[model samples]
Target: MSSTQPVESEWDGAKYGREESTGVIFGMEADQVIFIAVGVVLGVLVVMINGFPWGLAAAIGLLIVFGGIGIPRIKGNSLIGWARIFFRSKSRQRSGNDQFVQKDDGVEIGFTDDGEVEIVEGPEFEIMDGSVRRGDDTPRDGKNRIRPGKPVRMSLPGEFGELLVYQLPGGGAFIYDPVLKVATMVAEVMTEKAFQLNSFEEKEDRLREWVSVQSTIARIPGVDIVQLSDQTTMISGASIRHWYEEQILKAPAVTTADGETVRQAGPDVDPFMHQSLVETIMSVENQPVHDMWMAVVLSKEKLNERIVAAGGGVAGFMETALSMMGTIENAIPTSGAYVTKWHSPHTLAARTRTAFDPDSAIQVSERGEDGVAVRQAGPMYAAPRDIKTYESDGALHRTYKIAEWPHSQARLGFLDKLVFAGDFRHTVSLYIKPRDTAKALKANERDRATWSSNDKIRDKIGKQQTARKERQIQDLVQEEDEVTAGHAPLKLICVITVTAETDRELNANCADLETRAAEANLDLRVLYGQAEEGFIAGALPFGKLEV
Candidate 1:
């Protein structure tokens, strides 16, 4: 709907950030310089030996050395790292278990390639009747089993009590606690419903304003996680038909959820009304659903430190453990055991035990059919059965990456249609991170300078002129004004998750999502082979950037 204006950032200058990094010497890590030097020497020698073959080899070596391959920078493992995997012998590399790597911050941590922090398992420990005890296989008194009641929003790894933070398996620090997520979510839904009552222009203005605010929210501190919230809506033609038939049969006596007889369609109801209602429901975009997840990542090392620091270390750590449990117990509303995907706070030793022994993965769960708050051991871990399409706990899921944003500036409420568009169940989340104001200004200035230089060059070469450069200049000036006024810029990413009963249904739903997203000024690209990680980054409120 709008023309390309280069003022808008493409990928938020991830490469440019690297260029500006003052880390190490001249924005390059020591490891990087080593790779470059080695590549240069070997490549040049090869070139001297032959000619074309050597030249091509040297070019490739330089590219890998500089990571000149593409944008967004490499996520994990530099280009040289890739070469090492193939070229170096496995025995030459040290095993992750052999030693702890000290980080720049001076914390020792064992890291997996995925970036997840390795949990240090402690000796088997337990609490019996509120008294401290040790030994893993000891019979448990059922009093402290986990219960599924009102869900609690917990700061991650901290919930495990043994850890204060979880340096996400990826690169980033996340504070898992929600300052005000629930209330904000409720308000957003309510506001959307109320928007239908507004005038067209007023609604447009409101939408644009809201979009601006989302930009701001993304810029907040430690807010880089991609958020995805999932919801299910039943709006199929069949369901609509059932409801319509029920209404027709109970016409003039239609009842509410409470069974109160409400006014119904008149006795002379038009037969075509059913067709109209069905069409409306089927055509509705967005298929609005509540209850979505926001992604959160944990600072793993901090969590471990907190756990070890509690009650003044090993001498009084037992008392500290009991005291920590009491404090957390008071915080959570549910009784029995408290379970999380990673570890259970009620069972601190769960992670410690599991770390030492992976065989004992079972935890206290909603055991038996009655579903009472029972203290019974069961497996709650949902290990996916497949990679292409993950099937866990009877649900087939897939994730879509927001590969592109609207080229044209859109109205604020442009997404309202997408919110309730198709007849499906899914989640749409925005992972927002605020960039530092100074950094934002610097990036903006650099981009503007580049554009200005290009404009000058085009003029010097007597090339055809276009307004693109001029528009960029104007935009840069406006952005500068905004930044000067203290409005920090944000780095934002969006994702969508589609759910279905089976593979076929999932594909169908994904198609529907893609179509509806286009209508809503969105461009969704299926994550394809990367469904699980994408789902975790997008669907959960954990602020984890998909590194």
Candidate 2:
């Protein structure tokens, strides 16, 4: 062990560089094959020249050259060339440049440069660097993330390339080189449209059908009618049934000595009364028809009787009874035709004055349809003429005759008497006026003549006329019976005079009086004018004309 040989680190060039020892060839495989064939051919030539059999050696040399290189070169080139062709054909088949498809895994997709898509089994595939070209130039820089399920014409990060990596439903997409991955989302487009395709005639037919149904339902007897809309209505038959039931229930039940109670017999009943009751209850729950039944129950006479009994007659029963009576009266057709005749002094005056025409001195006529005849002064005895004047010793005297004979009595019928017998304050009025300046001056003679002529005279005359009219109106204000019973009635008449030019100031005063009377619920009437004779005539019985 101590005597072990030293190890050498450096090698001699002759031993390492020798061609036979190194087994090295300088040229390519094809060239080497050619050189070895050439060397064998030269050896064969030397062997032939040295007297060996030439034909066999040359044949052997040729066989060695062909076997060593020619067969392998042809087979290798053929396999590699076919492989390249197969790869390109596969790539083109999977290109999916212009169509869309669903993948087997239902996720991964492929797209081509021509905006086509192909859903695939695995992830998106990308072309390696410099493997695809833009026009004639191959790309050597950058990588593109591709969407397999989308169109291929979609933009990418790098220069124009054949492939792109895209995300699937569950996984992501990545580029081939650098192996970088990125996520993607599938885009969805949606659209909606609305249209009115019905014709006007179709709509009109529907409307007509609705109206026919409504009219038919409205004619159903015992049903309450209610309009819901222009084209719809609700008819309630439940109300009549309920009202019938309530009446039957309250129609005086009898109790026997044996303690058995008996109810009044109903108009009719079906075999399944319980079912009918349940059905009615269910049907009326949500329906507005129930309200009609409620009204019917409330309006029943027995229900009202019960209410009156429970709360006593004074508890709103009078008002309820009055309202019900009014409703019933209004419902009767004959009640609307009833009328009460109104009688006033004007009517009596016209009737009485008819018998005194001037044309007939002994006029005879029947008083009315009752055929009572009346004889009175005729028109000749009633017409007035101017006063005749006689002059003697520079003195003139005048004589005047009566214009017409006033009627002392007038006959009235039962209706006329009835009208005058009640509410006289509302039925009568009086108007007064002064006849002459002499009477006016006499009323105001205590004042200066000028002032009396202008204001004082008119003022005093107005006050007297108002007072006298008021007294006469008061006398008529009570009913005839009441007046006979010695009760003084209201003085309801008013009078106003304008001795001055303006009547505007009187309007407010009249309005105030009218308003006060209205607040007190009085029936006051006012009349105005300026002649004393006319006023007296108007205040008397059988005064004024009636149409």
Candidate 3:
């Protein structure tokens, strides 16, 4: 009489799953070196003791220490996390899959095969329209299990155009095109072309002004951009030559295809000797890169409302649409500027490829389970299990919610230290939801009225009115002016995610991040129960304030 109940074994993370994740000490696993050192020390003592049995005892102890006990955990966390990371930092990693999704704090890292690593928020959520089925029912690979439906419903009820938001597992969101950003960038370039600033600083300032202009543009409301990054070892000199030979040279006697080779045809064989030496020089640099992607998102309903406000009649709507089109089209470079195409339309497959295998040409419709069904969604699974932290794919992750913004106001570019921190792996994201101009104006007026009412009450109670309220009044005045001048108002949310190979490293990184936050004048609070949701809303590829 045997029971058929499944044996509930504990999650033994020590069971090596991914060969590449096996951590190292200096250049190798710390276990072997530590074992050797222990044996030597014990042998010396045994020799001093002058007993054969003592030597045997020492040998037995060595076996127990080295073979029996692997890397122990410090209260359920990796004890040798630091040593392992030291080795990983010095070496390379190869994954069979195209995408490796990892999350730490408010940062979610999506690594693609093409060396494009994106740090974003919001874990991908299955489509609510019963399109993406919850996968753990059978043996199937988790990659691309949730296929987005064709003719996906536009969630934001905009008059002009719709905004599409994809909720990822890590609480990061991916958005459709943000019209205002396109419009603003075009506007900035045109303004710069009209006036050629001399220095880089001038150009930067001009761009900064354009950024300000973008903040005020009301083309689309509830808009936000999600950014992600992955650290890729830069191409080596030898690898570059090999790629060049394969991709460009083709065969010895073949005439080169145009743009195939860095060296042009005829007399331009030598890249250095050619007229495009500057371009060659620019292209020659090979190094490790932290790839970055900024995804634009906006609300559809708000855009349509703005369009409706432009005119109720069809002619007026058409006129407004044409004007918006003109703004985007005229924004294109007509002069000697670089031309870059927008990303492909296969958003789901494209994102999957970026995350999984860079070379995959799999269509979105073709993507499905790969014979290894997941029990529960990874990021979404571990979060609720742990109170203080979440662990996934052998790495510990936590979410840091932005508790406070800068109290002492700083100028633009104040985040230089935190953003440009060269050491460690991390992701920074800002979610900006635009407010409609008319409603924003009404809110401002209501706020002012409320302030007046509060000020009288305070005066009657014999309390001194604070400077903060006064400043608010001043801010509203400026805000009104900017709105009148076609500037947009946006609600902003910011978060940072830090990644480490183990718990020890994670703890150390938390300290460093805290210090950086203090310097940046940001108050980052570790999310208690909101780890999963925070990652989706703040760190994924799209920004969803609703999370």
Candidate 4:
């Protein structure tokens, strides 16, 4: 179960997963090498046709312009790479995809048949005496005409649009998009024993169990794991006030000497004890609580066969999910966790509302359990951004991706510092995608070929490979061997999102976040120009990344 031994024998340890660079020759990317070769060939042709000095000067100019300016890395990407990103960002902006503005009128928020939001303008026909009438037109019964508007409904921007979320009967939720034909299962994960506090034997057992879980998940083709942590700070007296009120309600009535009924405000001897307790609690500082959720993302077609076999409706989907959930529930230990499934549509609405607008209070609806009015769940306003952070109602969010992980071996709970960094609101998410076994093996062989070619090029040029490159080669060889031995190949990405009510607070939290991540030996890069996508990937149980 253990791949890397612990530095100290008292703890369980594992090396961070590293992906080998696939440079073809002379430690340069394939594109770079191609450009250089093209320039050389052109210069040789010119020399054959013209003269030595002109061709040589042209060749030197091309080398200086292309190889000199484009080869060196800047902020983990080359100049050409940055140019590509810049053009992509500008293209998105020009297409009006970077910003979203909700329709001002409630009458224009209806959805078309294909799930696109329809915004139209027209004069209202007032209903009088049970009939809607227009000037000099025949009056028609209002009940007979289909209303062309959906109340307070608008589509979320980008990939979040056209989403439909359903609460399962037993537990968990199914978040799907009809247009995209993608489905995801989201479930909360209950707290488990602290890995750092466990004994050496317990640590080994835990690691073994985790390996088994990974193996089980890896067997599901085209699957990705999304683990999210939503940390909220409790600075208000709502909990204390609710407790005080509950105590007052539960206080037993006492009969006075005169046989009159008398009820105290609190259970204690002092009638105002609950009030005092509330005040004391309010005086203290805020506390942070973390909620963890794990989501499994899959293509809708993957589950279609099972759903059809089970009879193909809500019941059929539920049955299929229940069977699938058995493996997931056991692996993650979902007991005591709030699974987000509700028997009532009103509850689902409340959960959705809170998910999009954290500052908004959840209002209980009087609607029945039949179906949810999705309009009630969406946020009133959203300001999308192509930059670092965006506003979705009252909160500002900034997301960061783990550009570099710890190179040195550490304890099992090395991420605890980064997760529990500051007392501010934030979320830490991990996305794991298990690769297809055959494809992974083929890719590994191709990488070996590339490395061999690179080695030959380096030897011809009398340049020795760097120590880091040698280590990476050895690691790749070991990984290839492991895959041959039936170990699953996986790609993982870590995203962190920090949330705040204002800019100042958000900046302060982000600074603190960077410090904590550095302590954990993680290099965090802000997901600039992909803020909305990053927020969705990091802060929600939506299995997505900014690539």
Candidate 5:
């Protein structure tokens, strides 16, 4: 067999668009403007009453105090704004809304460090004539009972409500909304070629294939592509034991001519040999496995159209979703490395549970079971943020967003080091939203004009333009040119979440991630107060909607 080869290709530099604030005049809010106006009016009154130069000085002092001192800038917000945010956070903490705890029995919920809940028993219900009704013999329908032949409602975290997820056959997840009929299908992407290309030709071939697929997907309206990288360390003893059991169970056996059973020659007959084999397999435990997943979210209209075309029903939903999966598989040929398959409901639940609580252990058998969907997939306990980290189901997490990308061109696989550097468990999620070509071009042109206008204004004011500002203009021009040349424009957001069992371990893993990210020419900024939202965006595959 031929050996696999490495692949390399240069990548264009990236930049983030600046967020615009609309309700501001000269970088001041309406409240600040009102305060200034009121102060100026009071100062004029003082001038009218005192009628001297002292009154004029008092008016100027009032203006300075109201506009300068009261609105002193701290970071991006004024002092008063920061105070309001601080108080709001404190209020949430005091109210215990930021923490949650649920029992396995789904009864008597309680907060970990604070908060309280009172469980009240309610009247039972009964199913009569295929309709659930109250047991009181009154003609009242049971409002909460789950009816048959309808989509099951899933209990999700607040940020992920109005969404339901089910696993497909192989190892894929289908997240959908009952009301909207929109769906996001996720499948594991085997990208070994990314790190195993032998020549520049191979790189070009791969790029061509990827771009061709992207172009096709972009043309399909109401479809969005999201790429995610989920990295986690193997659970050593459990996996080894499971593998060893499977091997012994599947060992070959033969029946003798006399109707006596005979074991296969080697390990089946030798106990010592089996033990040695088990030990050998256990040696590579705790290895890091980095998995890439590609998800496609179909808009409600597109999905409804597919369902109708397939002759609507439960079967129609299944067939339509699978047909879409087939289309994706064809669009991006897997080269026989991996087949695109949907996740079974059980597997979907396990995956979501792991997404929210990375420390949870999921057995191999759980991935193939066809049992009822796992209803309690969320974490048993969660503290959204303790200032800098979020804790959920015993794991402490610190999440970071890419504040900036490399300012210069670099190789495509530059992120390999960051993804596989440390053994600690972490997740790197990349959310890519395809933009309309015409709209994207128009936006870029607008941005270019705005930048030019701002630069000219600065020059007229005797202020010098920075090198970074000049490079930004060039970047926009290059982006516009690429889009004009048939390249699809996309909005990409990346977040990384580091998971650990303890505070110390969490900190160390975070530091390692920072160092690796720096090495990869990525600027990472900690989520800090937004750890929970960051974790969901970084660690969960369902972040397609979040992004």
Candidate 6:
């Protein structure tokens, strides 16, 4: 076998490390030095003329020479020198090699083949003979390996010409490049998809918790429990509806079966029927299930129309319908019967009956000692003018009467007001009894004679009373306007009572309910007695409550 001599490879130090060389001061080459010196001299001359208190003539002459000639050359040289320095330094630093050694201490020494070095200490270091040094440890720890296919860039420190060497992983380094560091950070963050998974899991847990709370609250008896927020709850029930109906029944123009009008004792009739109808329609459109009472109301054609209108289209319709049903089911009507006249335009007369009775009634008393017609009237009796009559120009006579009318003037006045107001669009009432033409004729005759004799007196008295009433009404209207106009009034907001097992349990239940409501995008409010004095009463943006 022929022995081949091993060729000794040249130890090319240049290939292993960056070259360091000294030239003119501050690392500037000879040509740069010359340019810089010239620039400094020109700058000094200009400064002397502008800043110094030289004689005006000398200053003027210097300014002309420097400003017209010297300044341009100086500036040109300065710019050239700067360019040379920047390019040269950048090129040299970029050309530098990197030396990464895996020390026996499980640390690594990373140095630019130039002169700068970085000491990285850890068990993560790994060496690849003559190729590269890498941190083999997991990325989650502090491994310092650049990803493949990326380039390394270098940057030089200001005023020192010292380079801050960076490893552009796939290629080389450039001066002042931050691209490498930014890329590395992004790569690290991208590896953390596990964190995103954890976040999603947590969110799902919260949602599940909210659903459970909603299910719990829905089971409460007699209470229409609603979740208003994460920390608020609303407890409502059938009593609310009862209150609204009561208000409607008490409205000023309501009439009884006997053609007797009654005034509502409180505020205007509750406007909730229309509102409730609207809500019920909306709920039907949206939810699969609805409150029982709401379904009953929506069964009416007129009510359903109002609901559809209020809800706009399907989504609005669904929301309103569900809310109305919920509210109505929970509401309870007051303990009273509603009596309204059933009128048929096709018929001459309509009638209705009520449980209400006058405090007293007219009855003939047993024969007294005097044997005279003893007028025994109860607390209530017929009015004298209940019978009315008039004669037409062509006809012999005409007559009208309200038989067995109530005795009270207040009651009579109330009935009269309802008639004059004509608020009930579809119906009217009348008292009914057997007609007595003779009695009516007698009364008419007496009235005719009295009126013929005292026309002036009657007109004067009527005028005075009318004027007084008109003035009183005007004052009342003005006062009402003023009270309502300038500022918000102190409204007596309605109260809602929720019966719970206990105060503590109620609060806890409310908190949970509110959480569910928030998830459903519902607004819920919870007011403890402490938030305000006495029972809590308030209004919501979309609905009103009356206790």
The C-alpha TM-scores of every prediction are 0.46, 0.12, 0.46, 0.75, 0.72, 0.14
Task: Give a tens-digit lDDT track for model 4, residues 1-547.
Answer: 7699544552324466454456666556766677777767776776777678887777677667767765776656656666777777778788977665554344433334345665534322222333223233222235432122222232466657556544444424455555656656666564566667787676666766666667677776435554545544343345445555776777788888899776676544564775677777677544355656677776556667876776654345545665676666665442223343322223334434555566643122112122234444555666554367777878888989888788776656667877788887788887777888899889878877888888888899898888778867876787788789887787778888888888999999999999998898888888776677777778766666665
Clash numbers, per candidate: 47, 13, 65, 0, 10, 34
Index of the highest-TM-score prediction: 4
Estimate, for each residue in 363-388, the C-alpha lDDT of model 1 and write its tens digit.
21111111111011112332233433
Specify the poorest-scoring 10-residue window by lDDT in model 5.
Answer: 108-117
| Sequence-dependent TM-score of model 2 | 0.12
Q: Which rank order by lDDT, best down to worst?
A: 4, 5, 1, 3, 2, 6
- Candidate 6 per-residue lDDT over residues 1-547, each given as its tens digit: 9998843322211111111112233223456556556655665675676666554445566555543433232312334444554464345436541111111343333333223555544312112223224423112213432222111221111211121222222211111112121010000001112212344344344334433433332332221223120001111232233444566675668688988775564333344755765455444322111111000111122234543554432222223333443343333111111112111110000000000011100010011111111011101111111111111111111111111122211111122221222111111122111112344345434434443434455466673334433333343343345334431111111122221233454345344443433443333332211111111111111011211
Candidate 5, residues 1-547, lDDT tens digits: the string is 9998754334334444432222233335666667778888888888888778988888888888877754565544566666665575577788886776753443322111112232322212212233323222112126521111212234455535446543333334456655555677766666545454546666556666666776776666667556556566455554656656766667788887888875674465897987777777666545455656666777656556666665553334544666667777777673323433554444455566776666554333223333224455567777765766888888888888777776566555566767776888888877777898999999888777777666667778888866656666677887888899888898777888888988889888888999988898787877656666777778766644342
**RMSD per prediction, one decimal?**
14.2, 64.7, 24.3, 8.9, 9.0, 49.0
Candidate 6 overall Cα lDDT vs. reference? 0.26
Model 1 lDDT-worst window of ten: 181-190
Candidate 4 runs further than 4 Å off: 1-13, 24-50, 104-154, 170-172, 194-201, 233-287, 311-319, 334-358, 361-373, 376-386, 484-486
At residue 480, give the lDDT of candidate 4. Answer: 84
Report the Cα lDDT for residue 461, model 4: 88
Q: What is the lDDT of residue 272 in candidate 1?
A: 81
Which of candidates 5 and 6 reaches a greater lDDT?
A: 5
lDDT per residue (tens digit) for residues 324-395 in model 3: 433433432332221132222223323322222212222222232221111111222122225445444444
